[model samples]
Target: MGKGTPAFGKHNNKLVHVVCRRCGKRSYHQRKKRCASCGFGRTASRRVYAWNKRT
Candidate 1:
């Protein structure tokens, strides 16, 4: 019955996020080449919105 449980645990070594070079946060996607924290590869500016202001 639990077919998904065993399948998901087998591929746990996949490295998806890494330490971002700009913000130094662990949100950089390896395959996408884009930092989820600071928008390193996608855009020149940080990946943020006006409503989601940090302080």
Candidate 2:
């Protein structure tokens, strides 16, 4: 390993997902401030795709 490898490790070690304010899931991106599961903070309407089946 080189000395530069530590820098990469430090940058990649940060949290990628945090708790979402709406969905309350840990699928929210910490840096982007958006939820992956519920699409919170991105849109006002709920997203429904044809690929996703309804329960």
* RMSD after CA superposition, every candidate: 2.3, 4.1
Tens digits of per-residue lDDT for model 2 on 1-55? 6555656657767789888878888888978877887888777765456688776
How many Å off is the CA of 37 in candidate 1?
A: 1.5
Looking at model 1, residue 20 earns an lDDT score of 95
Model 1: per-residue Cα lDDT at residue 40: 93
Candidate 2 residue-wise lDDT at 10? 71
Most TM-score-accurate candidate: 1
User: Local error of candidate 2 at 10, Å?
Assistant: 7.1
Decoy 1 TM-score against native: 0.74
| lDDT score at residue 44, model 1, on the 0-100 scale | 92
Best by lDDT: 1
lDDT of 2 at 40: 82
Worst 10 residues of 1 by lDDT: 1-10
Per-candidate Cα lDDT values, in order, are: 0.88, 0.77
lDDT of 1: 0.88
Backbone clashes (count) for model 2: 0
